[model samples]
Target: MSTDLLQARDLTIRGEGVTIAPFSCSLGPGDRLTLLGETGSGKSLIAQAIMGTLPKGLCAQGRLVIDGEAFDAADSTSRRALWGRRLALLPQEPWHALDPTMRAVSQVAESHRHVAGRDRRAAFQAAWSDLTELGLAEAGSKLPGELSGGMAQRVAFAAASAGGAPIVIADEPTKGLDAPRRDAVVELLARTPEAAGALLTITHDIDVARRLGGEVVILRQGQVVERGPAQQVLTDPQSEYGQRLLAAEPSRWPLPKPLGERQAPVISASGLAKTRGGRELFRDLSLTIVPGEIVGVVGPSGCGKSTLGDMLLGVTRADNGEIDRAQGHTLGFQKLYQDPPAAFSPHWRLSRLLDDLVRRHRLDRAAIPPLMARLGLDENLLGRRPGEISGGELQRFAILRVLLLEPCFLFADEPTSRLDPITQRQTLELLVELARERHCGVMLVSHDPALIERICDKRISLEATPSVAKRELDPVMA
Candidate 1:
C-alpha cells in the first residue's frame, strides 16, 4: 500500500524551450500543503499542471501517483474522471469560474451532477443544503453578478466541497476577503480537507497557511526554494525568499491614523439616488467623508457598492443627490477592478501608460520613478505591458497611476480584491501613507467586514428600501 495519497516525482514543465525543472512533493491523507510565492512565481502554473490545464505549448514530464495508482497526463478520459471526483480545484477568479448566465444554485447543482452522477432533482436538492451549510441561504436563485466577491467565493466552496473530492487544490482562496471572511473561508477550507482528504492550497497569505496548519513549500521562478513545516518556515525561516514572504504578510503593515473630532465634512452627499435598468439601487442615501478619514461602505452583494464608487468619482452622475465638493479638491481616485488585466491597454507598456497618464494630467515626471519605487516596483518593469505583469503588479501599477494624479479624494472600489494577502497589506499600507501625507479623504468600497474594521475610520451599511406595499418590513432597513 502507498503511504502517500498524492505524489509527484521529478515533475517538470517546459514552455517555449525553457524548462520548469522537476520538483517533487507528496501529501498524506488529511495533510495540507501550501505553495507560497510571489505573483509570477509559477504557483498557479503548478496547480494547473496538476489539473492538466496547462497552456497549449507547455508540456509536462513526470510521475504522478494517487492512492498507488499511476497517473498519466496523456490519458484524457482518466484525467477527467479523476479531476473533480478525486481531485478538485477552487480556482482564483470566482467570477470567471462561475457562469454569469446561470443561477448560482443551478451551477452548484451542476457540479454535483457532473461529479457525483446525481439526478437533476437530487443535485438541485443537494445544492440548497450545501449552500445553507456554506452560509448562503438564498444563494440558489442569484446569478454570479448579484453576488459579492466573498459570497461568490463561498458559493464556489460549496460547489467544490459538494463533490467529496479526496484531493482539493485552492488558488488564492481568500485573496480579496476581509479578515473575518478570510478566516471563515480559511477555516472552511482547512476543515474540508480533513473531512474528505488532503489539500494543496496555493496562497500568498501567510495567515491562511498558519491557520490551516500545514506544510509549506516556497516556489520562486518555477522552482521550489524551500519546503518545510509551516510553523518553522513562517516563524523562523532560513531561506531569504521565505523571509521576504514573511515580511510581506498583512499583519506587518501599519494601521491608519484614527479620525479625530471633526468640525466640517470633507465630502458630503444628500439624497444620493442612482437608477439602472428601471431598478433603484440607492435612494436618499446620505454620508460624510472627512479629510484624513477612511470611510468604508459595506453591503450585501449587488447592493450598488461599485455604483456608489462611480458616483463618488464623478464617473456616474446621481439623478437626485447633491454632491458637495470642497474647493480646489481634486479627486485622485484609483479604482482596482477584480480583473486587473481588463483595466489596462494590452498593447501599451507600463512605462508608456504611466507616461501618458502623467502627460495628460500634467503631473511632475520627476515624481514617477520615486513613486514607483515606493510601491515596490522596479524601474525595469515599466517597459512591460499589463499582460507581461502579474495580477499583483498590474494592481499596484493601476494605483500608482492614480497616485500620480494626486487628487484630494481617493475612491477605491475593491482595490485589493485581486491581490494576494501580502500585496494586499502592502497596498493598504501605501494607501494609508498616501492619505496621511496628502491629507486626502478616501472612500473605500468593500465586501469584507474585516478590511473595513482594520482600515476604515467610519463604516456605513447600505440597506435596500422596501416598496410601498412592503412598508411594514421596516424603514430602518434602508
Candidate 2:
C-alpha cells in the first residue's frame, strides 16, 4: 500500500473569533493536490495553519501528519526542525519571501545550510545549479531588488526545491509571471521531486491546476465546497461557487466594442527609448491614449513593460523620448503590484497613509467611507497597518486611494497579477466603472492576455530591439 505523505484530519482554525470549518484531506507520495478559493477565503490561512505559524489570536484544532510522523503544533522546536527540511513552502509573494538586503545566492545557500547542513561553498554551488535549472542562469549574486518580479519568483522556486524536502506547498507560485514564464514555473514545480514526497498547491487559476494535474478542493468562504479531479471540476463544476469562480475571468466574457472616432489623444509618446545596464531595452517606441480608452501593454518576461510603466509614472527616466500630457491634468496612477504590502511603508497604519494622501490630494473626506465600502474594505480597517491585512485588501486600498485622486490618466501595472480569480474580476470591473465615470484613460500593463482582452480597448506587444543603433525603423506608431 502507498503511504500518505501528508494528511490533515478534522482541521479547524479560528482567527479573531471567526472559525474556518473542519476539513480533512490527504496527499499520497508523488501526488499533487490543489486548494482553490477566492481571496481571503481561508485557503492561505489553511496553509499557514499547517505550517504551524498561524498568527496571534488564531487557534487551530487538527491532526497534521507528514511523512508518517504526527506534527506537534504546540512544540515550536519540532515544527522548526521539520519546516524547511522535511516540508517546504513557497509563499504567494516572492518579493516578501526573499530578504531584500541579501543576494540571491546567499538566500538560496542559507536555505541549504538550514535544511541540508551544507557548507557555505557547497551551498553556493548547489544554489547556482538549482537557479540555472529553474531558467535563472545569472540569478545568483544579485540582490532581490535587482531581479524582476518573474525572476524573483523563479529564485524563490529554486530555494524551495533545494534541500529535497519531502513535501512542498506552493501558494500562487505563478503570481506576477507572464504566460510563458507561468507555464515554465508550473512545469518545473510539477516535475521537480521533493525527496520522494508530494506537492500541494493553493491557487485559483484553473488553467494552472489542469497543467499540474492535481485533485481539486474548492473552498468557499471557510469551507470546502467541492472536491474532484482538477480537469473535471474545472470543466464542469458542480458547486455554484465553483461555477462562479470559473465564470469570473473576463477572458471568457465577450469582447468589448471597438472605439469610434475620437476628438483628441489624451496622452502621447514619441521616440521613446529606455536603456538599462548598458543595453537598450526598448527604442523609438511610441503610443497614444485617448479619453475613455484602456490600452494594454504585454510582452514576454524581461521585455521592458514595467520599465515603460515606470517611465510613464516619472519614477524612472527614459534615456531618450518625449512624452506629452494634457496641461492642468494630474496623473492619477494606482499600481496594484504583485505584492502590495511591499509597496507601502510598513511602519504606517492604513488610515494614516490614506488620510495623508487624501489631505495632500485635497479629496473630500466624505468620499472615503463609501469608497472603502465599494472596495469591500471595512471602515474599521483604516486603523490597521498593511501588515495586518491580506494582499487583496491592501490592493483594494491602493486602488481606492488612486481613484480618490481623480486624475485624467491612470496607469495600472499588473493590478490583479497576484489576486485570485474572484478578486481579479471584481477589481477589473471596478476599474472599468471608475474609468467610465471619470472619463479617464487607463494604460494597463500585464502579462496575462486574458486580462488584456477583458478591459483594454487596444493591446500592444512590446519587443526589445536588436540594438539602440537602429533608429530608421521608427519603433513608435506615430
Q: Backbone collision count in every prediction?
A: 2, 1
Regions more than 4 Å wrong, model 2: 72-78, 192-195, 258-263, 330-334, 380-383, 464-478
Clashing pairs in 2: 286-476
44-158 in candidate 2: lDDT tens per residue?
A: 7788778887655677887888778887543334566677787888887787689999989888888887778888899988888878776676668789888888888888888
Best by TM-score: 2
Q: Which ten residues in a row have the lowest lDDT in candidate 2?
A: 469-478
Model 1 agreement with the true structure over 291-401: per-residue lDDT tens digits: 677877776554567788778767789999789877765444445565565578888888888788778878899988888888877676676667655567777887887
Assess each prediction's global lDDT (C-alpha) against the native: 0.74, 0.76
**Most lDDT-accurate candidate:** 2
